[model samples]
Target: MKTFIIRSFIGIFFGGFLAVLITNLTIIFGGLEIIDGPLFVKNSIGSILCGWFFTVSPLYFEKRNLKLSQQTILHFLTVTSLYLILALTIGWIPFTIINILLTLVISIFVYTIFWVAFYLYFKNQARKLNDCLKRL
Candidate 1:
């Protein structure tokens, strides 16, 4: 349980950092100017929340014997839906479409890397715990 909390925090911190980095890079190189508005804050918070939620989702579901593929799909759908609703609430339909597309592109890469790291860390811990239990 302690390991799970530590790994989740690490994943959220790194994942949030990566998402910010990517957003800045897009503004720097892609010629996209950062919009300063309530929507921006909404999007930023939504991304971080999504990162934390997805990071922990797989671990929680795995204990119930859910397959990785199923967990991944479930996380994707759940996060995407949450993001869409948040975006729509902030900026209506057109802005929500834009937000969803951009968020999807950035989040797919960021979360995939974070998820893999978290999974490997927890898997190793689970193995170690199983070994310790067997020894007792």
Candidate 2:
């Protein structure tokens, strides 16, 4: 359980960092404005929370024999709802639509990358453990 929490935190942190990095990169390339600091903070937090939800939801759904489509829909709804609530609580800005959309896209991309990285890491670890056990 502790390992799971640590892994989840790492996933969320990296996912949030990736989104911020991409956003800043785009800004540096003159693609978008830097926007307000508080808004960006909200976005980063939302991305991290969404990343956690996205990482775990599918596993829970799968354990319950849920369809992929159902899982996808639930994931979308869950992330969207959380984003909206956080944004609202943080105060609405005129660029709410753009903020929400950009955050959602970046969060999804970062979360996907984190998921793949974690999956590969665990797979390799499991293989090493199996090999060690066989040798023992």
Q: Where in model 1 is the C-alpha error above 4 Å?
A: 1-65, 92-98, 133-136
Error of 1 at 67 (Å): 1.8
lDDT of 2: 0.69
Error of 2 at 14 (Å): 2.9
Give one digit per residue, the lDDT tens place, for model 2 in 1-136: 6655765887698769876896688688976755767767777776677677656544544546776557656765676567567656656434577877877787688757865786699799999999999999
Pairs of colliding residues, candidate 1: none
Best by lDDT: 1
Which pairs of residues clash in candidate 2, taking residues 3 or more apart in a chain or in different chains? none
Instruction: Locate the minimum summed-lDDT window of 10 residues in model 2.
Output: 54-63
> 1-136, model 1: which lDDT tens digit per residue?
8767876796678667866886787789999866566755665666666567656655646566777778778877787677567656655335655656887887798878878898899999999999999999
